[model samples]
Target chain A: MGKHVITMLPGEGTGPEICEAVRRIIDHTGVEIVWEYEEIGLDCLDKYGTLLPEKTIKSIAKNKLAIKGPTTTPIGTGHKSANVTLRKMFDLYANVRPAKLIPVLKRPWDKIDILTFRENTEDSYAAIEHMVSDEVAQCLKVITWPGSYRIADFAFKWAKANGRKKIQCVHKANIMKMTDGLFLEAFREAAKKYPEIEYGDIIVDNCSMQLVRNPGQFDCLVLPNLYGDILSDLCAGLVGGLGFAPGANIGDNCAIFEAVHGSAPKYAGMKKVNPSAVLLSGVMMLRWIGENAAADKIENGMNKVLAEGKTLTYDAGGTASTDEYADAIIKAMN
Target chain B: MLTKATTGRAKRPAKPITLVGVDVYIITENGIPAFDDYGAFKIEFVSNRGTKVWPGYVSEDLMLVNWYRCRFMATKAVTDADVDSFLTQLSKKWKWSAAQKLWNYGDEAGFSKAY
Candidate 1:
């Protein structure tokens, strides 16, 4: 059988170095995979005059499955989101992030396993926004019946497939009645299709408070665009910081698993950073490509590394360099 | 204790808050002058925008401006009688049917820097 190939779009700042480490670690593990590299992030923006460059988009379009490093997003400013652009472009409407408790990590919660299946493409993140007339700026929150229903369906399918008992739909329908009201209604319609899974809705703010108070009650929480972004990151903090968080942008046929964080410019080229986010994302990549053996191997190897607490990164509370960490994992795998 | 500006010195903002072409003014909450133009003061109040500080504007249209524009309206020094007359004009023009005397939708689209 032909080897499964995946493109790695290393973006600006520390994006390239981390990608290089990911390359080295995957190669050394003898993980059956092929690499296709592309230049993205700052360099791409400078050359192509936009963050979402044609080459990167073209690469993603061809490959159908890729794992990417971080790109910077200037919040609430000029232009829209980079991730939002990709999700909308490819119709990658379901963002799936599964956070499980890594052993020996000083986390607050127990049974800390949750999958956030966020509505990926629509709502405030669409960049369909304007600062119309200096005093009053506006962002049009567009919610369609089809978009909400499909994302809800994806969440329910994921829950049922994975044996998840509860599926929570988070929204701000009480305050934002019209837009979020539509999303809640669509969630209900999709729930009818998957009656076996238990379901309920929570207000967005209360949801945040609940995650902080008790994250165990959630199995898989799904939400619209902006709410999902904030909730996912908040949930990421619950398990570990965002370094432990990994996400996948999924459409019907296309899926891009990536390290969904900013380009940490200061840590560029140091080889002292943690690559687990991208590595786990690579694990997701392996799963997507039907290389489940390699995927399990990589995950088991990672869990083995985390269990001993040997060769941990600074963020993970140790002095081990990025190479040191990956080498430790590979050693455990061996 | 009242934190007054330095004696004999007018305090200013670090950055000048310029209201571009907006005919709005704020009168200090000190002893406001009488607004009843007919009952009246000897001289008319004036602003940097050259709009008359008329204590007599009863435009139902003007009262419907947004917080951004409404907060910046030109203020004439006004007294109790001026307030009463202004309130009466506002009630009549805006057609204040309710007891509290306010409009539900205060003409958001019609609000602008002009007037």
Candidate 2:
């Protein structure tokens, strides 16, 4: 079979390093992938004055799938979120992240596997901000019936397809009744349609507490956009932090798997940071295109390499550099 | 914030809880026709054990007797009782209310799924 072409938006900072390592690995494996490189992130910020440029979006639309590296989310003010903007513009209604227990990292739980189907676009992260007055600040938390219905339906469908037993509708509806209430109501309706799968709701606050207390109890988490962002990060810490957790922002027509970690500018050009997250994201990319075998090769090899614990990096408590770690896995695979 | 100085002030005192916005008929322990007040039942929780257990709001206290596990109390509370009766009553109020508030708040907290 001829190679399938994929685009690479290797953003600024360690983005380049990780993307470089991933690209090298793809080439080394003799996997049929043609990657097109493009400039984005801080470099885009300095030159184009936009965090996400029109050209980047256009290219991504053409490819329909991409492997992205960490980009600098312009700090301070007046900067658009490169990730959120793409999700909204493309209507990537679901953000799926599966945090598996990579045995290399020691955690309190035996099995910490969970799949989160977060509703993209339309939540606090909508980036719609307005000040009621000088003394007051307000942000819209919009949740339309259709938006909730689609996301909720999408989640249940995903859970049923994946053989997941239950779908947890995480919400703070008790507090943000009107907004989250609509989400919960949608979940109720969706649950009735999919009687095969179980449905449950948890107050957002207690859900967080319970996550730490017993991470295994939860299965599939479906929530509005904003809660997913905060909760997913915290869950990252539990399953080996950002260094290991991989994320994918998926829409109807396109999917972008990227390192959600920020560009550690200070660590730029050092080649010292862990590239596992981005690489694992590449694993996600592979599976996205039905390359389940390649995806398994990378994941199984990674799991074995980490568990061996010899060729380790700082994040996993050893001193191997990004290349060293990737090299170890590549060698181990051979 | 409550301080230790106020410790033991109410010591199981039967302070009446107001059933501010509810009223309903309840069949009493004697099988007599009686109205059980959900609000008053919840307010009297501290002293009278009038727990307003709605659906999914089960709990355990004294550790042995789980506080919120009353399926019979799954019905919404209405006016009547100690504010008049036993702590046990059937209710179908909001799934959360005070007892299950913990779980609802937890959901608001964030995406907890590990996978």
Docking class of 1: incorrect
Per-residue lDDT of A50-70 in model 2, one digit per residue for the tens? 777767777777787888898
- Global fold similarity of model 1 (TM-score): 0.73
Measured with C-alpha atoms, the lDDT of residue A324 in candidate 1 is 89
Evaluate model 1 with DockQ and give the value. Answer: 0.02
Residue-level error in angstroms, candidate 2, position A323: 0.6
Task: Give chain B TM-scores in order.
Answer: 0.21, 0.16
> Candidate 2's interface RMSD, please?
21.5
Instruction: Estimate, for each residue in A1-334, the C-alpha lDDT of model 1 and write its tens digit.
Output: 3576777877767777777777776776566567788766655666788777777777777887777888877664354446655665566778999888777578877778989988875676543322234344455466767778988999998889768999988999999899899999999999999879999999999999988899888888989988898888887888887787888998886788888777788998887878888888888777766667777887888888888888899988889988888888888777
Question: Model 1: which residue pairs collide?
Answer: B24-B72, B25-B73, B34-B79, B35-B78, B35-B79
Off by over 4 Å in 1: A28-31, A75-80, B1-115
